[model samples]
Each structure stands twice: as structure tokens, then as C-alpha cells.
Target: MNDDLKQAAGISFIEQTTLDRATIRTAYRPDYGAAPAYKSYPDAAVLELPRAAWQLSEARIINLLQRRRSLRTFAETPVSLHQLAFVLWASQGVTALAGNHLLRTAPSAGALYPIETYVSLQRVEGQASGIYHFDTRAFQLRLVVEGDQGSGLAAAFLGQQFLGQASFCLVWTAVSRRSMGKYGDRGVRYLLLDAGHICQNALLAAEAVNLGSCPAAAFYDRELNDLLGIDGYEEIALYGAAFGAKQETTTPLAGR
Candidate 1:
């Protein structure tokens, strides 16, 4: 039978490596002090994020979905700190303490939340423009590399000018050590899936706030890693998105 023959034949090297590349990518990299499961900065000055409201808008699921669009254009207006916090929380905020792990708005394999969020703030009110690491445990922003990074990020994204014009950018990096330590090669797949969940939440949250956002994966890998100052070996930049206020030219909601 075809089923029997298929079972007898094993996966080709191409097939195997394709699925396992995520783990192999980091496995070959020289160990970088084995990143801890939960990443946070103890020394950096932290900006306390206001507790985000649960009901940011009265939008229903249908409305949020219909309004969602991958907008490239953005207004020059500065997004408020509160608005930023709400979007950040919706994306990867810690919701509950589930024993040893903290449950978030998105789920992860084996509850190993391997994705760490970093942001480049370009025009957030009352916040300096710089690279900041989100401290999910404490709900705060820890300053990492300070100063405007719009131009540099735009270059890393292959001259995607829209990135530089956005109010802020959310960079999601996968600390593979957290997942690969347990799940091995399979964990890499989990990391990619987790990023999608987090990004989608961001999109919906942006719509609720009437902000424009575009999730982007087409970027130069090493360049982006260097931009974020993370080792491309262990903590690799897997996905990201640019967010800002909506410009008049942004596409309107679907009429369906």
C-alpha cells in the first residue's frame, strides 16, 4: 500500500534539515553563557508602564477582524505612552501566575515563553527614543541602547522606509536556549508559532486603538540582530512589526 511504502521511506535530508534548521542554527553557534529562561535587566533604569486597561475599546471580534489591515503608511503624530503600553500588554503581557510559569495573552510550547520583546521607540510621548527591553514580570521598560534607532532599523529591514516613519517598532527575538533546552529541534517550530500569536494580538489591539500596524518578516537576519544588539547565535530576531498612528492614505476597513 502507499501508506506502507511511505512509512518505510524516511524523511529526506532536505526535509529533516528544513524542519530542524531552527535548532541547528543555534546549536552550531558557540555557547553564549546559556541565556536564562526569564530575561530581565537588574541594573538598567526601568520605566514603569501604566497598568493597561482590559477594555481598551468596545470592539467586537468581527469588527476587529474586519478592520485589521497590514498598513504601511503612518501618521507623523506621536503615540501616547498609555497607548503603547496597551498594545505591548496585549501582545505579550503576563496575565497569570501558573505555578512556575507565567501565563500570557499568547500560549507557548510546554509553557516555555522563549520570545523576548524589544522595542525601538521613535515618537512615543513622555518616552525617550531608544531600544528598550520589555520586562514582562514587572511590567516595565528597561533601557538598553539609548537614542533614536529609526534610520538604523530601516536600513536593517532592507531600506523599508516605512519602518523609520512608524511611531515605534516591536522586535521579537527568540531565546532558543529556553525552548531548545527541552524540546530540542522541535522547539524552533514552537518559537515561530508563538511569534505569530503574539503579533496577531498586537494587530487586534492596534485596531481597537485605531492605530496602524504591519507585521514584517522580510528582513536581513544578521543585520537586524546587530541592530538589536542580540547575539544572532542564541537570541535571534525571528519576527517584528512597525506600529504608528493611521495616516489618511492608509487603506480603509474591509466592506465585507
Candidate 2:
């Protein structure tokens, strides 16, 4: 192999190599305490989401798994608030509570749940076009920025035009300290894995409801974080996905 290729492959192995337990415990611990598991916006206008009916879909789990694909094209149909609620629930809905701790639809390392979900609402019924934070604990949307941001969001996502055509986009961010307290540098890895789990739930949920979704990682980091009004240091954007009704040509995946 060429020298450059060998160097690139070596970097991958270096990153994935496990650290000794003693070094992990002593070298990586932060001086400060861990961040809170959940975030809240007190002054932002709150819109209570409808309770997600734990309704069963006719689509078998195996079929949903087999047919799941990255779909970028969206139809002109506006997504109803009910459908939006289902997608959010499937992604991060709190399923149970123990004392003060909460369990969600997606699994997280140490149950830290470092990832937070934000939505850029473009064409949802009965909801204004704006940016909103998913208040997972309360199952509500806290308005962050009001008014249509679809065009700007598309720009932030590296000019992916399909984003502007979708009804809404799910933006996932990681609050590093949530996982760092326990896992230290390794927490960053867990944060990414947790994001994948959350986005996968969203994709499957969208497909079950006859909606189309496409997970995207290509974007300008600083620009997207700035647009979401999150500080890039403590919290940063990690993953994103656009979802909406599929065009007529897109066959329904639930039955297959």
C-alpha cells in the first residue's frame, strides 16, 4: 500500500483501540460535574403535543427492516400534527419512569441519553413554520425560533435541496458532558452510537406511517449549530434526517 494510504488506515486503528482501565479512569475525568440529562426552555412558547397512541402498524418488523431505505424525495402533502407526534414518540418518547430517571424509546449508553432532538417545522398542519425543541420529558415542542426556516435550513445542511422540500427535519445534538462523566473520552463514541439508534427509530417510524425519510450527516457544523441556537462546545449537532409524505411513485413499504 502507498505511504498515504497506510497512514490513513493506521489512524483508524489508533482511534478504535481500547484504552487501559486505569488510564481511562484517571486521565479522562473532567473537573466539572456532568450536564443534566434533559434540557428545558422556560420562556419559549410551548406547544403541547398530542398523546401518541401506541397503535400497532400492520407492517411486520422484518418487512419494515428489509424495506427501510434512504428516501430524499417528498410529496407536497402537509404532514398532520398527529403524524409528527408519532414520529417524535417513536424517536424519543418516554416509555417509563423510575424515581426521577426516565426511559425512552431508544437505548443509550449508561442511560445518559446525551442526544437531544430538535425539529425544523416547515409544512406541518396547525403548526407555524419555525424551529422547535422537542421537550421529551413533557412531550411538547418549545419554540426556539419562529417563522419559516426551511430555505435557510437547507442551506445550513450543505445545500441539500431535498431538505427544503420535506415537511420537517429532525436535528439531533449531543451534550457531551452527559456521557463524559461516566465514560470520559469514550463518551463521544457512545454519543454517536446513541444518535444512530435514535435516527433509526425515526426512519422505521416514518416508514410505518407511510412517510419517507432520509438520514443526513453532510452539513456545515458551525452553521447548523448556530442556527439551532446551541453552543457548539457543550452541545453540538451530530445527526439529522428529513421526513414527509412520499410521492405517488414511491411504493408503500409497510406491506412489503
- By lDDT, the best candidate is 2
Instruction: Report the CA-based lDDT of candidate 2 relative to the real structure.
Output: 0.83
Consecutive 10-residue window with the lowest summed lDDT within model 1:
5-14
lDDT of 1 at 124: 98
Per-prediction TM-score: 0.75, 0.74
lDDT of 2 by residue, 1-256 (tens): 2233223332234233323323444556446878999999999999997655434673377667877888888989999998899999999999988677799999989888899999999999989999999999999999999998889888887789889889999999988778865776677788889999999999999888888999998776667888998765567688899999988985678967
Model 1 agreement with the true structure over 1-256: per-residue lDDT tens digits: 1232122212121123231323534645445696678988999999997644436463386688989999998988999998899999999898999789899998888999999999999999988999999998899999898999998888777678888899999999988768766776666778789999999999899988989999887667667888888765467787889999998765678995
112 Cα displacement, candidate 1 (Å) = 0.4
Instruction: For model 2, give the RMSD to the true fold.
Output: 16.5
